[model samples]
Each structure stands twice: as structure tokens, then as C-alpha cells.
Target: MPAKKAANQPRKSMKIKKGDTVKVIAGTDKGAQGKVISVLREQQRVIVEGVNRVKKHTKVVDAGGRSGKSGGIITTEAPIHVSNVMLVEGDGVTRVGFRRDEVTKRRSDGSTYTAHRSVRVSRSTGEEI
Candidate 1:
């Protein structure tokens, strides 16, 4: 059987998007800022450009017919929990908010319809992000 949906269930989404500048507020990398590379929605974690780096050691594999990649210790950015980072607005970081804007949209038959679109806004300055 399929699972039932909650009537009052809120929208599930991450405010910080790719290319957004964010600052680490907690953990060992606190105060470090970088662009958002990816968001792991299921894990509720985000991979920043230069934050939470980890080193991985791998074994080298050789292929006789084709070129193979050399294995060594490589450093890579790791995902950080969403709660540990804050979105950067200007010189400081601000909480994110959502607002609904009335928009005019067209349909497949060339009919126009009015709809409310949700947009992310900066809570501090009340400006769109």
C-alpha cells in the first residue's frame, strides 16, 4: 500500500542553491565561506566548495588495453550538515525566507493564467536572493 500524505506537511526544499555563497557557522571549519557545489537533500547536507575537506587514499589499478587512473591520497570537499552553514547575503549572513508573487503564466493553448510563485528572499533586507 502507498503511504498517506500529511495534510499540514510543509514544503521540503533547501534555501541554499548551487553557486550560492555560504559560510560555515559551526564545526571545525567555522567562519569559512565558499560557493555551494551540491546539496544532498536526503542527507540534509550540502557540499561547499572549500569547506569540510577530507583526504581519501585509494589503490592504483592498471589496465593493459586502456589508460587507467593513478591512485594516491587525494583531498576532496565533504558534505556538511545544512544546519552548520548560513547563506551569505552581502557582507554578512542572513536567514532565508519565502514570499509568494503573483505571476501571469501562459498555457499550452495560449491562454493566460494568474498564479502565485514562491521565491526566496533575504530575511534581513527583505530582498530577493
Candidate 2:
């Protein structure tokens, strides 16, 4: 049997995004800042470049190709909880907020359209991010 979806469930959104600069606010990597490489929405975790690094062990692969390949200990970024990082806007860290665009447009058919587009804004300065 499958689980039922709740009607009152709120949509999930992340303040951080790929290529966004962020500062770690907690955990061992605290005080570290880097670009967000990936976001794990289902896990509520994010992988920041140069943050939360972990070592991986692997075995050497078959060297049947043109170049020989060998696997060893590899260090890579691990997922960190999204709540532990803050978006970096300019010189400081700031919370993210969404704002809708106010401009209206007309279609080729001449019908008016006012679709609102959400934008990320800095919480401290209220500036567009």
C-alpha cells in the first residue's frame, strides 16, 4: 500500500542554491564559506564546496583502457544540513526572502499578463540577491 499525501503540506524551498556562496554557521566546518555545489532537498542537506569534506576508499579499476586508472583515498564534500549554512550576500551573511516582480506584460494576442516572478533578496539590506 502507498502512503497518502497530506493536503495541508507546505511546499519545500531552500534558501541556498547551486553556485550560491554560503557560510557555515554550525558543526565542525563552522566559519567556513564556499559555493554551494549541490542541494539534497529530500534530506534537507546541502553540499558546499570545500566544506564538510569526507574521505572515500576505493579499489583500483581494471586498466584495460588507453590510460591506467587507480583508485585510492579521495576527499570530497559531504552533505551538511541546510540550516547550518547561511547565504552570503556581499560582505556579510543574510537570510533569504522572496519578492515578486511588479512589471506587467502583453502577449502577442494582446492579452495582458501580470505573472509574478519570485526573486531572492537579502534580509539585512533588502537588496536583490
Question: What are the Cα lDDT values of the candidates?
Answer: 0.92, 0.90
Q: Which regions of candidate 1 are displaced past 4 Å?
A: 1-11, 65-69
Candidate 1 residue-wise lDDT, 1-129, digit = tens: 999878787757988888899999999999999999999976789999989999999888775566776788999999999999999988999999999999999999999999999999999999999
lDDT of 2 at 57: 96
Best by TM-score: 1
RMSD in Å for candidate 2, one decimal? 3.4
Candidate 1 — worst ten consecutive residues by lDDT sum? 61-70
Candidate 2 per-residue lDDT, tens place, 77-101, comes to: 9999999999987788999999998
TM-scores, each model vs. reference: 0.86, 0.85
Residue clash pairs of candidate 1: none
All-Cα superposition RMSD per candidate:
4.4, 3.4
In terms of lDDT, which candidate is strongest?
Answer: 1
Task: Tell how far residue 115 is off in model 1, in angstroms.
Answer: 0.5
